[model samples]
Target: MDNLTHGLLGLAIGALRRPDGQRAPAPGQGPRLDGPGLRWTSPTDRAVLFGCVLAAELPDLDGFLPAADPVLQALQTHRGLTHALVFAPVWALCATGIARLIYRRARSRPVFSYSLASVLFAHLLTDLWTGWGTRILLPISDQRYSLDWAAVIDPFFTLPLLAGALWALARKRSWRRSLLVGLTIAAAYMGFRVGSREILVRRVERAYPAATRVEVFPALLSALSWRYAAILPEGYSLGRVSIFGPVEPVRTQDLPAELPERAADNPTVAEALVWARVPHVSIQEREGGVLEVRVADLRYNMGGEPTLQFVVLVGPQGETLEARLERGGTIGEVYRRWKDDRRGALPAEGGAG
Candidate 1:
């Protein structure tokens, strides 16, 4: 989701995890193993509120790393290996050490390390759902793990949490209770999403009895919603259709083809080619280059926005190519479905045989 929701969740986690107190627990007393520390359970103080926000938001700074993303060049510039899982503990420790030294002057308060850790952990968990995934084991290994479930900007996922946090802030009441309510709502929304996908799948199957394969997901970044694409024969040329609130659903055909090289033949393709200006737009035989190419309406996607998008194979000569795209949650799945359909469309049929 967005920062606001994460901030609230971070705050909630902070509040619940800490101990109930207006005064700091003795240094040796330490917080309960599962309890929040100092500012977490204290009567609502403006500084504590601010600290909660900071604790939640600060860790996301690493979302912009150089080697972190493929299609999105910006991540490569920021949010690097420092944000990985293995690094999370080390990062928190370093941060706590720094805060311990720097904020020792605060006579009546404990350090801010607890809150910092809360925000960092929240950031990592939020990233676990997006398409790009997170590298929790950074220094150990640069592998990425993601649920491939939630979109980057799910409203259902974001709003409830934000509302709960706001309510907590405004009432000066139970931040813990409010946090639980909001997170519960967010969890329910996730359930709704899975149910909604099943609904879409059943509906699409009923509509297109011939659909050999079908896949559905909410539009990338669209919370608690979904989009669908199906593969059949030529009658239904690769198309994208949106399912907004269950009203008869609308469809749009004209999905972009995958082959960037094919654009050389169809000037129409050239006219629409985005990122063509980029140096690496040419075809490359990547690891999983065994597929067709197609362009998706990735404008709504976080990083891969362009008018003239490119795809892998399905070029003029039907060449094998690589996917140089950084995918958001939704459209990437569409591309995968489209590629699956083209397995039978090679220059010579039954090539797989």
Candidate 2:
């Protein structure tokens, strides 16, 4: 999500339902730091900041999942099981519990369950339109859905109104006026998103000429433009250029999935896991096996680099998406430059005791 989006989300939440505004103290002033795991704070302001940042970044927590054997990582950060609806409530509840305990010690009012839920909902909704899909329902079942009505980033969708939101809060405008301004902006975006999707659908149908059964979603984070991906009888492919907006739909292609020479857990597997895109969507064999991982990245070249494709994954039998991980120590000593960098990768299995 954009920083501006995060900031606006935070401010809107604070103004709309903060005790500092008019709402009754729901509970202790609770934890305000961002990110998952335990968090705590003493002051209302800090708590609000916590609420805001958490609301902003909560959708991306699944990016932290470890890769399975024969790793399949994608550059798409938010397209994973972590974005699933089922996982969200559990994560939120756990975080809320931590806040409740911490606020108990500080004797501050814990944030209302309402506020927490509000933020979570906002996070999910914000990501719902982008090209990268989010699986809101996971574990109950692997059901992935999206509107695909916006680009990876959008200027028309958020800029002017988000700017107004900041101005309203900074100048201390009445809550109603500020909220109205924000809502108007949001409403306009929704309208544009619809129109954009319609245009892409028409163009896509023309491209295929005889295509049947199409699915299109605007890439999340994109402003008004959309990224259209569809499944054909042969295979799946992204649509052509936006023709109106800044987006360029990726053309579909058929590629071969080259399995890792050895589909066993190790550092190479970890490398692939980071690229898997989904934090929770990985192979976990009870007695050593493989998984069908689907990876999508525009940069992949099948006959050339073996990566940079729209969908890439591996399985016990064959390839779902053409995917494989090549080793890299570090790039200019910027990342993965040390042993500890691997700490964030999924824990390795089949290690020595």
Candidate 3:
């Protein structure tokens, strides 16, 4: 999920229940809603809300932390230790403490800490829906887990969450009920998407009896549509699934499962095989008869230029040389440059010049 969605989810969680555990206001202490916007009924509500929102975004702090290299950053940085379930409570404690100092509200520290921890846990849960797996149980094990149920950015998911948060931000009397209903609706929608993906995967598996692996990825903005790939011994096939329309024919591309004997030892190839959910490998020749072995993760393609890529340079005699893992389009215009470089260097007759 995106940062804005996380913040709104935090807002909804914060408004789920007040610190006092009263769903309704006191007999004569009804909340005021006549102002420009809804105001927190008490200092404690404001503090907890703020703390939850802050804790929701704290896991992304690793993006700002300096890393020795991109490999380290990809494997052990953002969405690494910070997003782990083990770290959520500790972070919630720190965040709640800061909120206490800021609001100085009359609330039990333990209660506030628990509420904030729940909000942080929500962040981890949301990330698990996307293809970019989160290291939820990190330290215990470095494995990343994902359901591949929702796209990183899904308006269908975010809109309801935002609506609930906004309602809570505006009207105080029934705020708790509003957020609970919103959260339930969002969860249901996610479940629907998961079910849809499962159907598509089954269809693909049935169509390709020889498929060794099959994975469905979420579309950019639509829950009704999905893209999937099935890995076969000789190559792989790609297709799009529409929940509302007839199934389209699958597109097959032939790519050997085995790389050149020389590239078998390349570290870059090893890294990408482990990292990519749908790995597509190709061998190309560059200048000076250098063998450029490329592996791309099709999960992030989204029908556009490829993003995540691992490249290795092999000598003329098939000896492994230097290798690199690169990403395109992350920083804008850089992707275009990478694309243009590849096109311009293409050998007209046969192989590299």
For model 2 the local lDDT of residue 106 reads 25
lDDT of each: 0.48, 0.46, 0.70
Evaluated at residue 213, the lDDT of candidate 2 is 49
Please write out the lDDT profile of model 1 over residues 57-126, one tens digit for every residue: 6656655544312333323323346456555555444444444454443322422555555546567777
Expressed as tens digits, the lDDT of each residue in 280-339 for candidate 3 is 677877899888877777676533234667676778776557655676646666655545
Q: Rank the candidates by TM-score, best first.
A: 3, 2, 1
**Residue-level lDDT tens digits of model 2 in 286-318:** 223555333334222111111222223434544
Quote each prediction's TM-score: 0.53, 0.54, 0.78
The regions of model 1 sitting more than 4 angstroms off are: 22-55, 63-72, 75-83, 98-121, 135-148, 198-215, 220-224, 231-353
Q: Candidate 3 local accuracy as lDDT?
A: 0.70
After TM-score superposition, the amount by which residue 21's alpha carbon in candidate 3 deviates from its true location, in angstroms, is 7.3
**Which of the predicted structures, 1 or 3, would earn the higher TM-score when compared with the native?**
3
